[model samples]
Target: MNNQLPPPPAQMMQLITGFWTSCCVYSAAKLNIADHLKDKPQTAHQLAEATHSDAPSLYRVLRALSSVGVFKENEDHQFELTSLGNTLQTDAPGSMKAMAIAQLGDHYNAWGNLVYSIKTGHIAFDNIEGMSVWKYYEMHPEEGVNFIKAMSGLTGAVIQHVLPEYDFTSFNTIVDVGGGNGALLVAVLDKAPQAKGIVFDEEYVVAETKKLIAKKGFSSRCETAAGSFFEFIPENADAYLMKMVLHDWNDEQCLQILNNCNKAMKAGSKLLVLDSVIPEGNEPHPGKFMDINMLAMTGGRERTEKEFASLFSNAGLKLARVIPTHSPMFSIVEAIKE
Candidate 1:
């Protein structure tokens, strides 16, 4: 007989009820609770007043999050910021506060309809929100702006890891296809001071991207181009970068974008696709979960190395290699135009 019994049932329950924890963190972030506690410990009542939340209810949520190491609830019912909680602070460098709001607040409704996606193989975001995510952002400009900030926050940390691992020394001009707010493109140009860049996106996004590029003093080295990736990209760049862009699209849509890039590239030019590659086994990887998130929200799916190779081949490009970086969430899926 096998020596071990089945594991405790509570673990299963915790997994099933994981959304409860997600919502608590989302609520805390939305209330700006960490910002309030940045200076010192504060009782729940004080926090409630600052955030305009119910004192008892706020206390319960904070107490729960405290158990998970997000905050420390003292003997006196005061809460102090923990290292993990500090990352939620609005002013913290690489802060995830906006991302928390976007994912758990703005994207939460779509995620709730995950079963719809499984049944119909359609985008849950469209079903629940009455339009695609891009259209929804167009209608709600403020939310769109917040979403951009959230993306910047998430990518800011990722770019630091990417810059050191990838070499841009040889490329003179690079283009960031679907680059939002020009954060990643600016970072790239800053690193390769001799290299120039272009931030290509929809008209509205490029309007804002211009401001960001100028703000970073990359106006001299970086410029903005407004267009759809499915139609055209700037031509003849030494390198084309699509970071976190491919995973937001289905294969057909991704191929359309890639075909455009292929047409825009010179024979020896490169395409640097930065995204998480789903590992082959059952080994724990965040991309496996994030793939489902893409399916739910964007009608996109993350891929394995084999899938990426197929994508490149279909788009008339050749997969060169997959370069690992310090960041586990993404890798450089390098390809060359044939």
Candidate 2:
């Protein structure tokens, strides 16, 4: 084995130019190039006509992506979708298409101003867009819907790893606080057969969540509620699940949400928080990067176990355990109402 790292300059250069790859992937996703290439290989000219893009320009982009193994270029100049590229397809299981578009489109400007966020200790997105992301979503419904889809896709990708690592069967009622689209709740209900669930979120989000519950044929076992976690949560659930919710707020806001959950929880109830629990030291963890993303986008952060314990204690709960999933990006932070 080589057992050696890349030279510092080479590594630094790659890190500096990482956005070039991101942009290339974003372009392919934006143009639906993966979907077009899904069936079979096609020449750039053919793909260009289908996507209404310039043949030469599209070919150049495809060629660039091919170098990184997203797609493969044949001897005759036809591009074929690789396994990695399949993830960008619109309907692929755990698709990244929406994520690609949103991060590069709506989130691009905010990320560009990351320095401003660091300097001011504020959300760059709010400053850049002149409104909070939640408000911006309200004004631009299309982008809002896409943002929701992006989240759903991300949740879908991690659900398998999360479900198998923990037991949900003991609870009679599972409340997915801030659960969007009912995907996680529906999946949990499916695993727990006897348990009913509620997909709780804001009114507009819950309206869409209802449709997903009904579409999944879980309408009988799962329901949707409209409200904010800051004000209230559905009361007396056996278990409450908050997947990727708390990380969107600062400590003060998280305390408010957690306090509400505590108020609604019974003495014995369990709260399962599904988000990254960042490790200490110079680890190459995704949560560290995501922590920065949270800072720029929502004024939130990924917390360490100590930080979570503090939040739990202040919110009238005790940290029970932190269970690891197969995926490194998430963990089940189980807490209990005392």
Candidate 3:
């Protein structure tokens, strides 16, 4: 192809320097960077002073983010909000600040031990933190809330995408397993007036879901159930829905969850596993990296369509179809309780 290629390994350089981007995000999140810049932009020194950090170092970080178009640098060295950076600000319309902070917190450490996860198929978090991710979240309330908020923040628009894609009108009672804060269930029930739903999750977390149900005026039709996914799921449901649930667990445990759903369902019951169906080829999808994140944090792996079919078969169900979304990151993998 080209001849003038004896230079820096740009690809490798990018890979190695990827952590720098993380550092910048963390730096911004830590400085209450987005919060400070919400109403107006400020000088780097002013931002650093307000955040109680070293001025010059903060300036450097801001400049790095500016280079990536997260923020715009003026000739006067004032950093102004760019469109991309505004998404990082905390607010309803566009918010990912919480997510950035959480990922940069405990997740960063777990990701650091990716080799351990890849080699042994064990959660790197357990080895590094001496605690399971669940246990850690239970013990750390603030971080747990932040994580949930982050998830809700990221999945905001996803609610709109789901309503039009799936046929919820055909079903009556839908139970959302591990439904955190009842966001998805709320969305579905709000859209489908004929359908009733239950949000199932742990007692501690389901408390929040109850509040959400009440707030959303879904109290009459939507209920919250406290339960564990591994032990058992409630019986008597027309449809079982699990969104972003399975990928947190390994195949064995995934089967356990599916079987639990199977035991609860009658024939002809629909089972919707809302997750990303890993596509074939190295076509540069973000989900591939998400699969790696699962590997690093939990002993779970994302499944391809064929893998889902096999998995469903193991749980005494048949994979009916995979409904692709406008979102490449997620799909509705439909199965049936047979």
Candidate 4:
């Protein structure tokens, strides 16, 4: 005696249209359409003319995005920014413009060959560039800069969440082991006046952090060191922090990095890993998708609480606590050297 049947399944069409949506988003980013409409609405014709794209085709793309809430289809073929669409505006404080462009840019091609990674367990970047992503980036500085910019922009939101949760007051010295441009290093130093800081990474990355250190007028207290975390790290710091670093590698690589941190630390020194912990079971979390992205890209993973603790224990350390923040998207897992 059922009165109605369930709605038709939207899964297949949604999955099939994912690329179309990505291309739509990419087109908007490339044309600066989001930036153009940040302050006001624009008609399809106006946007097409401004971006020099085909009016009809561009309108179709915009319409499709409007259907998905990236933009609004106001009356008279005009488009206005939706809340979700504002993330693509570069001038916005917490902009994801760079992330969108990068995801939909060179990486998109690599992702197209996801089956290659799935079948072979080798990186698609290696297939594309005849080398790993790091090597390719090292050989191409322009691309490397874009890669860094994309990472920095993506991490900005997460770091803003992390800034308040942890108490940085107690430690006099904090070392960002894999700190990229010293953004978090600068943030920590500014908040904790008593803390001296060291921003450590490869030469190319840490070199630029010096300018930031200079800008912060902590030139004397804050310094940059060039090194690799795998081989060894600058030792004897009161505390060490790595943000969004470990998930870029497999468990063995993660253990190597953590062991390096442990070797460099005295008893009671802290190691902070800022990353997403893949919660157990099918409970639904963004990290599950990210875990797959890691698998496809670097053969890495977004780990769970137990996985994190095991990694810490493997490195001759113990899990101190899993500190949650306002942003459930990331957490700080603290481990102390044995």
Per-candidate TM-scores read 0.94, 0.97, 0.92, 0.91
Regions more than 4 Å wrong, model 4: 1-8
> How well is each residue in 247-296 modelled by candidate 2, as lDDT tens digits?
99999999999999999999899999999999999979999999999999
| Overall lDDT per candidate, in order of appearance | 0.91, 0.92, 0.85, 0.84
Give the lDDT of residue 149 in candidate 4.
78
Model 2 residue-pair collision total: 0
**Most accurate candidate by lDDT:** 2
Q: How accurate is candidate 1 locally (lDDT)?
A: 0.91
Q: List the residue pairs that clash in candidate 4.
A: none
The stretch of ten residues in a row with the least summed lDDT in candidate 3 is 154-163
Write model 3 residue lDDT over 196-277, tens digit each, in one string.
Answer: 9999999988987888899988999999889898888978888898888998888899999988988998999998887888
> Model 1 TM-score?
0.94
Please list the residue runs of candidate 3 whose C-alpha ends up more than 4 Å from where it truly belongs after superposition.
1-8
TM-score-based ranking, best first? 2, 1, 3, 4
**Candidate 1 backbone overlaps, count:** 0
- On the 0 to 100 scale, the lDDT of residue 331 in model 1 is 90
- Rank order (by lDDT, best first): 2, 1, 3, 4
- List ranges where model 1 is wrong by over 4 Å: 1-6
TM-score of 4: 0.91
